[model samples]
Target: MQLKSSEETASKAELIWAITGILVVFFAAMLSMNIVITALPVIVSELGGTQIQYAWVLTGLLLANASSTLVWGKLADMYSKKVLFQAANIIFFTSSLAAGLAPNMEFLIGARVVQGIGMGGLISLAMAIMGSIVSPRERGKYAGYIGAVLAASTAAGPLIGGVTVDTLGWRWCFWVGIPLCLAALVVVHTKLKVPRYGTPGKIDVFGVILLVTGCSALLIWLSFAGTPEFFEWISLPSALLIGGALAVIAVFVIVERRIANPIVRLGMLRDRTTILAAISSAAIAPALFSCLLFLAQYFQIGRGFTPTEAGLMLLPVVGGNMLGALITGRLITRYGKWKIYIVTGAIVMSTAMFGLGFVLGADTPIWLIIGALIVVGLGFGAQMQNLMLVVQNTVPVTRVGQASSLIAFCRILGGAAGTAILGSVMAVAVGTSAVAPTNGTNPVYAEATGTLFLIAACITSVAVFTNIAIKEVPLRTTV
Candidate 1:
């Protein structure tokens, strides 16, 4: 891939430094979400938490993160990206302080919600800023670097969390990200700059209220569905509420179409590139997130690995992600059509999911599990960065913030829904079967989790087909 005029014109040192600074923040923010995976058992035990409550520990943050991404993205468009980025860091840092000092699960969960807001902003806005500074043709290289950071943070999150919980207690999972974020905040404040589109339009207030309420309700229902035994597949009340939520979403879309300053531009969905990227995000999110939740459980509960040991055992997944991101970035630049990689990635990821489903059990071989994980990670890294690039490239420069936000929004929502649905599946699967243990450390849980992954593989295979549906336009000779 050839460098853009802007990139070629940049002093190599300056470009490297900027990329490094952004990635540092990216790593910290990304790591904070999953770092607590291995620490869950200890945290729950100490806090006197129930299994349902423990699930919320994750769902709460994911919900908050998903809900606020579009809001933050809009703000970034209306205000200075640099200032908003710094403020988000401060918010995350302050929340970390609260989390570190939390004596109970409620306090920790509350702080995580706050922390997630900042995270939601940081991830999307950073990409918005990056798109502004780098030409579309040259953005792949920088995105590749960001993708590597993402993989490292995700892969290492549990590892770091395990070490922290064992050595310094679970609080450091939140606290550790605080100081690292400071450096990212400072770097953005000092070095990055793009002109602000000052207060461009009023926020679509009605749309915001409806969409958040609608999505939150849907997510809440999914999260609690099986645990409380709320409703069966044929239950009348459940069907009505879920159907009503769908209705509200339909009305919300209509209202969004009428609003000038919508939360997400309805028109953007018409763009094939943006649509495909968003669809792809929605498909893969559940597969990735649910795996994290179940895999940790499998290792610690089923395989008799300690939290720290489980974290260490998953290094192959992280390492593969780092390599995949680098390779995808270069290939996108060199080849230009992004769909082939996305399709290949989805296929590879689906294969990994199937493998995980089959081989997962109390007595599963470590080598096979690790190999499957590596394949999954490679597929994840290969596809993640390019989705945002596809959307950003498809839209005009003025809509970059909106496009970035939509991409982030889709992925986070996918993640939240994934966690809820798959988590529910695991709960119900284990509950109904004779396999699940009364003590949570049951071989039944492993089989149920693997079954959930099989479902994920089917879903990802659908995404692979959607990837082929995308039409890649030739890059503009000049923007």
Candidate 2:
């Protein structure tokens, strides 16, 4: 996404500072989502929450984030990216304040919902701004840095959350994020500049409602039906949820097709780059997100490691991501091509998935598990941001927000669907929604987990084939 040469080109030093400022906001947004994961137990106990209430604390954030993703993206096209970015920081900081001061579980959960609202905008708008400033040829280097931040923050979240809970108390898990958000706000205000497009006529209220409803309903169904203690997958409630989600989505499509200014640019899917990116995102994202949960489980439930120790064990995967992203970014910039890396990355990821499926297990040594994960991380770091660069490059600047956020939304939706599929298969295989590691035993659990990874591998292999269909468009040198 770029303007004509008539538009002023940003200076090299300016772009560097701009990217640096955005990275802090990006890191804060990513960290906020995961920082509460390991602190939940303490928060629940102190607040005397029920099991369902405890689950809601996390689910609230997820639902809000999913529902708000597209809306925020659309807003970016309508308003200044800098303003939206700063506003998102305010919202996140405010929610953190509320959550830290929350006297009960319900208040804390509600605050998280607000936090998610902020996060949705922060993530989407930051990328949209990045697209506006950098050309496709150079975006990979920045994207790689962004990917590294994302990977590191994700890996560090539990470790930070656990330490916060143990030393400063559960509330500080929320309070600790304030300084980071504040710094992002200051940097963005001082450094970032983005021109707004034509003022959008009357906001697309109807479309926003439809999209939020559809996404929320879909996420709700995934959260509950996928849990064995909740509604069974085939139960009446689950059927209604699935049906409602589809109906809402159908209505949303109709609205988008007819609206003057739609929240989602439905036409983008017609583009080959977008279609390929969407497919790859849908196919491969589950392997990343599901493993976050599974790896934690494998370490804690299977190996009986403490939370901090488990998080530490996952560091190699994060390290591999940083290494892979930096190398890929430099090579892409030097060669002025991305498809080669996309294809290679897909093959690498598929291989890693297959190895995790067939070669690694509970009895498998820790070194072997880490080794397989490092390969997966490398493959993921290479493909994730590079694919987005493809889609963003193809779309015009005005539609960049929609294009980038659509890819993000696709990954989220894919992860939810993949998790459901994995959970259902495991439930049917082992008669449990959750796997329990017992005395280093339970070959059935290992086999079920392996089977899930195998399914992921088969799905991801589709990307290698999909990449072949993409024609190489020359990378843009100017934004």
Candidate 3:
């Protein structure tokens, strides 16, 4: 009995260290991704970039993150996850250094793309690693910790950026996460000890190339369309780009089906719960990403708030996110019911988004806007991690990495698309040649934000039905 008790204690200690190591990496990665939000306008102006290029800074990262997620997921299943996680931290650290020193807009965008690749690994691998150790039934309790880290990093990013940009300059925003990343690397190396699950297999190189190519083409077209220098929405360039993207994606589907070791197993997606969860993830992602990204711009440019002030104003949303994640995570663990929270979250998110649209003018009451943001955050917090939890429940432990990453890929892809589309919409609303409204308050830009949130509301509402349709299975009690 003493021996058994000792083994249990050791196991618990190992789990604690493992989770701590990964959460550090997770926090750094998310912080790096968001730190630029408040500083983007200043960064673009200093670099002599256009409104289109401004949006590309974000979309570029999301695209790389989305595209590389599957590769990392597949690799996690085959390789030593501890080593892979460390490697991702190195990549993120290096790219962040490069981004901080970038001499031009193009260089910064390139560095961000590389940074996104590292972020892709961190995000997917963190979840994959968690799935490897914790059973689905127990994951809900731990997921609260993960969600709290996510919320903290996300909330801290804008505030950090705001402070860094105001005091040190915009470049420091990129540099701030390096220390965190290095610390995470040290912890992960010492603490994370997980067995490699899958045997070495052929990676689908062609599928990756096709997926990246197709998605990049689509995003580029979306970002540039309806701009003065680019082709109109109905023009030949649009047709060719859209058609070519579709053709490449179709080919990718075929390749995945034929490959012995596919990056994404199509068969896994056939399960009804997986499909519904994926749809819900994809649908809700845009609303979450768009709102958070654009709100920085709204506060800084629309309301004439300083970066520091704008960051402080976002606290309500962050509070909501933290509360929602913590509360739902505990409840799910206790009761083993998930669908209700996600569906209700979707409905709440949609309502908040619409409310934001209605009250988003430059002169709208601050209290009213804050209330809506809190609700939006609450809705997002409930759905984000739970979607992956449901999907992970359906798969065996060996395939958890792939299943978790697939859902992440969908969410990031949707975010990239939404950022590109909504950026274009705002650009069009502001006039094709208009630069980013960095100079001062622009009513045109402020009005366009309202339109952006309305579109986000429409897109997010789809998740309500999808989550409702998701059939929840009993959470597995064993890892």
Candidate 4:
């Protein structure tokens, strides 16, 4: 009995460290996502990359991220998650170091892909591990910490990236990312002792192969669809790529269905809550990525702010996300309800987006832009993690990682597509101009961004209805 008690105590201590380590990894990985966002313009200028390359920079990371999330999630159920967690950090840290030293646009894009692969694991496993440790009922409170870390990391990334670019050089963003990545790895290596939940089972290698190839081809095709790098949308290359990608997806679905251990159990999505939560999660990605990547452009290139100034100007968004996450998370934990916040967040987010679209122009006041950002941030703060909460609650304890991955996969998939599509749209609208100019007087850029926001507002509205379908279940009290 004394031995048992000591073991239990040690286990509890390990759990605490595990959570801390993953959160640190989570922050580092997510920080990588946005760190380069504000720095893109500078990177582009230095590399002499085209408008399409600009899109590829963000899309590259996002595409790899979305593509690998499901794979990593499934792997979690097959291997020791602690090991996987550490592996992700090593990959991320290595990639970031490589990216910082990239000699050209191609090197940078390739590095982004490697960086994203690591991030996929970090993002999915962090949540999955959280699900492993805490109950759905208490997840909200804990998720608040995740959300705060998320907000802080994401919020600070751009600012820090901008300052680094302004003061040190764009390469320093990736270098800075390395220290955090290293810190997270050290913490996990020493402290985390996550129990193995995976039973003896074969990893569906074929399913993974199909998922990666199909998703990659699809994202690449989407990235170049209407851009000059690829032929016209109606051209043979476009059709073949689209058709071939679709065929690969069909094959993947079939492979997953027949596999004994599918990466994504398609049947699990039959639950209304899971399906709707997924849809809602997917719907928000385009708007989220578009805003996240381009808002900096709008500030620097459209509103005449310097990179550092633009990064600072984004404070409203940071503050809003921070407040929304904390307040909504606590409320959900207290009341044991989640869908209401999700729905409210959707409505608020869309409205705020529409407000920005309508009021924003070449000459819109900066204060108004900041105000809209705050409201949208609040909505995102409320909406983002609760979707994971709902999906995790709906699934079995063993399947939390799977469901959580699905949510992330859908969101990042949407981001990849959105960034590509909107990037092309902006490229066309702006007409062969360097993406950023000092004065922020590009009327065309302003007009195109406004249209994009309107579209995002429309897309986000779909989530409001999807949330209605999210059936609230009794919250689970333990892992």
Candidate 5:
């Protein structure tokens, strides 16, 4: 008995460390997603790329990441997760190094496509791995750790990206995280262990192709839609391409429902909690992401702040997010009430969105901007991972991969759609503005960007009620 107890403690300790270490790298990997945004305009200007091309740089990564998420999740269910996780980090590290050495924006964008593949694996697999280790009752503690890492990464991304851009040049931003990735690899290799589980299903190759092709088309259209006159949504070629993509997507959904082992597992969508979480997550994407894009631009373009200064201005959002994560974790642990946080977060987020929309203008007060961002941060921190937890806790351990991936997919889709639609609106709004001696006033861009925020606020207001309608289930006691 004594010997058995000793081994059990040792195993648990190793598992905890492994989970913690892998998550750190996961955080670092995700940091790159947004880190490049603050520096992208400068990178594009230096590389002489057009704005539409610049947006593609972002879209390529988003679509690849979004589509691959389901693939990784399905693989985790079929193979050794530790092996897959390590493989992903290796890919991420190699891609970052390649990105750092890229000759131009085109090369950098290609490197990011590789980077996105690895990133998609990290987020989805990490959640699935956690489902294997911790019981639902105790998962919140570890989830808190994950939450902290996420908030920290998001908060620190722009700051780190800005500093790297200013001092070592933007390439170093890619190079800097390589060592951290290696560190995570070592920790997982040595410390992580789980009982082997036999694969039960075959890969759905057809379903994978269909999902990828459909999402890829949407992202391609979004990337080019507003940057050039020829890329307009109603334009003949654009309409044909987008129409074709939708038809493909509709076919893919049909395929998913028929597959014995579907890549996405549409059966989960029947769950009230899962469906609501996924939809709300998708809807909230436009508001949060578009804000991030425009605010970063506002700080840099409108306010004339350096990348570093813009990063600093974002601290309130980051700080508030951390607080919200902590409180929400405890609330779930103690009360088992998940929807309240979602409702509250949406309401708070909507209020902040409205504040930022109409209140912001040239020469607006920085303090007020920071205050509004704090609300946005609180809503995000409180709401983001909790939704994942809600879905994760509700499903069986075997289904964690699909469920987690689905929620993540919603968030990714939301972000891509938000950036695309809101970006077009902003561009048009900017075009209608007065020409200036310094920076020509783009009135239409400002108006459209502002309108997007109002739309985001409205969405969140609706989310508040949708959240309220969700019924809470008891947290799972075991995986």
Candidate 6:
């Protein structure tokens, strides 16, 4: 009995330390992503970059992150996740240092792309590692903690960026997460002890090339379409770009089906729940990323608030996300049901997005805007991690890394695509090369933002149907 008890105690300690390490890595990755939100405007301006370049700063990272996620996910199934995670940490901090030293928008964007490659590993591996260590039934308890870290890091990031921009410099936004990244690396190396499954398979090099090329083509088209200096939406360039991208992606799909060890197993996606979750994730991601990226611009440029004040204004989002995630995670754990929260959250998100569309303006009341932001946060928090939890529960233990990372890849892809499309829309609407005028308040920019939210609302509504259509599966009790 004493021996059994001691084994249990040791196991518990291991679990605690492992979870701690995962959370630290997760927090650092999320912090790196968010810390650039508030400082981006200043960074773009100081670097003499146009609004299109501003959007690329975000899109570049997201594109790389999206493109690399499946590769990392597949690799995690074959390699030691611990070593890969540490390698990713090194890449992220090194690129972050490079980003801080960037003298031009092009260099910063390039560095951000490298950072995203590391981020892709960190994001996918974190969940993959968690799914290995924790059972689905128990995951809600820990997933809530992960969600809280996400919320905390997200909340802290803009504020940190704001303060850093105000005092030290905008470059510090890229630099601030390095210490946390190093700390996470140390913790993960010591505590993460998951076993590797599966033999090393041949990577689908051609498929990766095709996938990246297709996505890059699509995103480039989106970013420049309808701009004065670029091709019009209905032009030959648009048609060729769109048509060529589609052709390449279609080829990628074909290759994935034939490949023995596909980067993204299209067969896995044939499951009803997995496919629906992917759709829901893809649909909702734009709203989440849009709010994070564009709201800062609206607050700073359209409403003429300082970075600090803008960051403070976003606190409602943080509060709502924290509460929504915590409550939903606990409830799902207790009830062993998840579909209800996802459907409800999707509905709430769509509703809030529409509300923002109606309420946002140059002189819109701060209280109304705050209310909308809160609702948006709540909806996103409830759905984000739960979607992955459901998919992980459905898949076999060996495929957890693939399943979790597939969902993440979809989310980032959607965010990247949405940011580009929306950025273009804003540029056209404002009738300027930049999203905002250099000098004063632009009512047109405010109106453009309102339109953007309306589009986001429309996109998010797709998730409501997808989530509602998702068949509920009971949470698994074993890892």
Q: Distance (Å) between predicted and true CA of 159, model 4?
A: 0.6
Ranked candidates, highest lDDT first: 3, 6, 4, 1, 5, 2
Of the two candidates 2 and 4, the one with more favorable TM-score, higher being better, is 4
Instruction: Provide the TM-score for each candidate, comma-separated.
Output: 0.92, 0.88, 0.97, 0.95, 0.92, 0.96
Ranking by TM-score: 3, 6, 4, 1, 5, 2
What does candidate 2's lDDT look like per residue over 144-188, in tens digits? 888888887877776787677667877777777778888877877
Q: How well is each residue in 270-342 modelled by candidate 3, as lDDT tens digits?
A: 9999988888888888866667778887888777888877788877787788888989999999999988899
Better of 1 and 3 by lDDT: 3
lDDT of 5 by residue, 1-479 (tens): 11112134346678768777778788878787768766665676667665455555666676677888898888887788888888888888899899888888789889988988898888888988877777665666667678778778877877887777788887887877788898999898888875434376798889889888888777667655654554676787788779989999999999999978889888888989889888888767665455666666666666667777777777787777777877888777777667778789888987898887887776567888889989988887778878888888877776777888898888877777666666555555555221112123333343454676776676666667667777878886656
lDDT score, candidate 6: 0.86
Error of 4 at 238 (Å): 2.5
lDDT of 4 at 39: 88
Q: Which ranges of candidate 2 are over 4 A from the true structure?
A: 1-7, 37-60, 100-109, 226-228, 359-361, 419-452
Tell me the spans in candidate 6 whose CA falls farther than 4 Å from its real position.
Answer: 1-10, 435-439
- Kindly list the per-residue Cα lDDT of model 1 for residues 1-479, writing each as its tens digit: 23244444456666666667778887888888879887776677677765555666777777777777888888877888878788888887888788878888788889888988888888888898777667776788778989888878877899998889879888777788877888887776666646554475687778877887788778767766755456664567667668877988998999988877888888888887788889888888866666786677677666667778878876777777788888989887777767777788888988898888877777787788888989988888788888788778787666688889898888888887777777667667656412222234667766676787887787777678777887877544222
Error of 3 at 314 (Å): 1.9
As for model 2, its CA RMSD to the true structure in angstroms is 3.5
After superposition, the stretches of candidate 5 with alpha carbons farther than 4 Å from their true spots are 1-11, 196-200, 226-228, 432-449
Tens digit of per-residue lDDT, candidate 4, span 1-479: 11112134246678778778888889888888888888888888778888888888899898889878998898887787878888888998999999999999999999999999999999999988887767788789878888888888878988998898889999988888777778888888898765556675777788778877887777767667776655677888888888888898899899888878988899987788888888888788765566778877777777666778877877687778888888989999999888789889889988999999888778888888889999998998898888888888887667778889999999898788778877877776677735555444566676777877887788788888998777778787656
Model-by-model lDDT, in order?
0.77, 0.74, 0.87, 0.82, 0.74, 0.86
Q: Note the residue pairs that clash in candidate 5.
A: 429-444, 429-445, 430-444, 430-445, 433-443
Clashing residue pairs in candidate 2 are none
**Runs in model 1 lying further than 4 Å from the true structure:** 1-14, 197-199, 432-441, 476-479
Candidate 5 global TM-score = 0.92
